[model samples]
Target: MQRVTKERCLEIISRFEPTKEGREKGHLGIDGFTAYLLSEECDIFDEEHKEVCQDMTQSFTHYFISTSHNTYLLEDQLKGPSSVDGYISALKKGCRCLELDCWDGPNDEPIIYHGHTLTSKISFQAVIEAINEHAFSKSEYVLYITNQNLIFLLLNIEE
Candidate 1:
């Protein structure tokens, strides 16, 4: 780090100095002024002189969340492959929210893919399992899952 010499401090304060008429009679000289400016009164590193925030509480609206759309698509929206890897990747990268486009699949199972397009489909169950396994690998914050679908499929499974 560069050292702050008396000459440098004088040079810096000279620009802000008042005109001859504005200066008070027997006012402080350059050396005295520089010394005063560099004293404890002007030292930002003085811990006891710093301002502290007494109220640490913050409203939920004050926070910004990180989210992603079409989180199951690994590449381009149209031709990408829908896989649980996408969800895992997003979660590991600190995405607090993920979007899954769901649709009906074979045997009445739900699958995720880009609807009305050529994107490959992935098992919704696999995506959910992946999320459960890796959701907290990178961060301890809550993760929200939002599905985009015309119909919600209901199923019963014993853990």
Candidate 2:
């Protein structure tokens, strides 16, 4: 059998990271390993991406990808990923796929809330700072992944 090398391992990881399942918490650590990749390149050791992906991956294993019916009720009403909760809930209830909208935030933080609600009280930097502090706690329910260009606007009304 061919021995797995770091480059070969990275090649394997690159394929998995794009899937919703690969991004899940339980699988994140174990799944990123390739047959012969170095510890540094493994997703388990990448501090920055791990920070953002850890929490969001919490329930990924149990949850199946699905769509929400309520989205049609608010299709024209809400904008961006803010509708994820409704869709996530619907996915839990049995929806198969979902559509999410996204918008840019100050400093490109990608606020996932709908519309311009965050524009008044906080800036993207402030939100990132706050998330840095609180995101890992049990009280919060967001997974913080960095996007190169597009910003996310999530709405966590439950909080």
Candidate 3:
């Protein structure tokens, strides 16, 4: 049992050949084993994201990456402030959903943001564009409920 990096996870997935003799029966991305090692060897998953006194369990398949700091990262790159790069990075990281805040804007523009004070500005359409454009390797899931029309747009948008 060992920790699983994304590359290592991919490697393990690659070895799951159904044609193999004894290896023909189940999901083998090594999640439970990896979690056991982390819990026993190092106190890694010992925090709130772990479990206690029970058979080991591998968690959900999806990875949740936060987009809060994305704005700052993009801002850092610009040496000022920007939301563009962060929005792009979140999509690249395969974010299943984004928690955003929006306001009723002039000319029916659904302005997306996190707070009353605008640190960076992005419209609902911009977010959709980024997600749709990155659809090739993306897992395509809910964009969450922040803006209803945007969510509706996502639902109706065909592949």
Candidate 4:
């Protein structure tokens, strides 16, 4: 792996700095940083379309990658039913990116569910299995699975 040095970091910051003084001083303003973050070099869609040959400079809409949120929910994210079939359905619908929420479950097994809601939990293993079976069914695009890791605190009070 290539290690990032201070000089390389400064170079990257300067590339995104809007003001000449900030660039010379290796300072990244909020505007410059936000622009850098929203740029194609750091965009997931651009990363997935690395093989495509086109004009490098374009708006975000130029990338037409489809994505899904709460992929395991059949209805509302707050109180919907979660199932492995959701993953299958989303993949079949040409969703190249799927979002999932994972939390600690019984017996140390991780499960997928919408926390603090009525959404039912589905086995993380089952979701993975479903994805493995249907990820490439609709398109040859690389599938990006984004999972939100949750941490909880249990409180005990004596009245």
Best by lDDT: 4
* Model 4, position 40: C-alpha lDDT score: 73
Q: TM per model?
A: 0.56, 0.24, 0.41, 0.54
lDDT string, candidate 1, 1-159, tens digits = 168786665554553345453243434566656665776656667575234333325653465767888888878988877778888899888777788788999999999999999999999899889887887777655666677543222222236
lDDT by candidate, in order shown: 0.71, 0.40, 0.49, 0.78
Model 3 ranges off by over 4 Å: 1-82, 140-159
Model 3 TM? 0.41
Candidate 2 clash total? Answer: 17
User: What are the per-residue Cα lDDT tens digits for candidate 3 across 1-159?
Assistant: 467676665444445423343233434435544543454444544565433343324432344433333332344333344454565676566554554556676699976654545456577677667656763345444443234346332432556
The per-residue C-alpha lDDT of model 4 at residue 135 equals 78
Q: Residue 82: error of model 3 in Å? A: 4.1
Q: Candidates 1 and 2: which is better by lDDT?
A: 1
Give me candidate 4's TM-score against the actual structure: 0.54
Residue 102 in model 3: shift from native, Å?
1.4
List ranges where model 1 is wrong by over 4 Å.
1-59, 149-159
Q: After superposition, how far is residue 51 of candidate 1 from its true place, in Å?
A: 22
Ranking of candidates on TM-score, top first: 1, 4, 3, 2
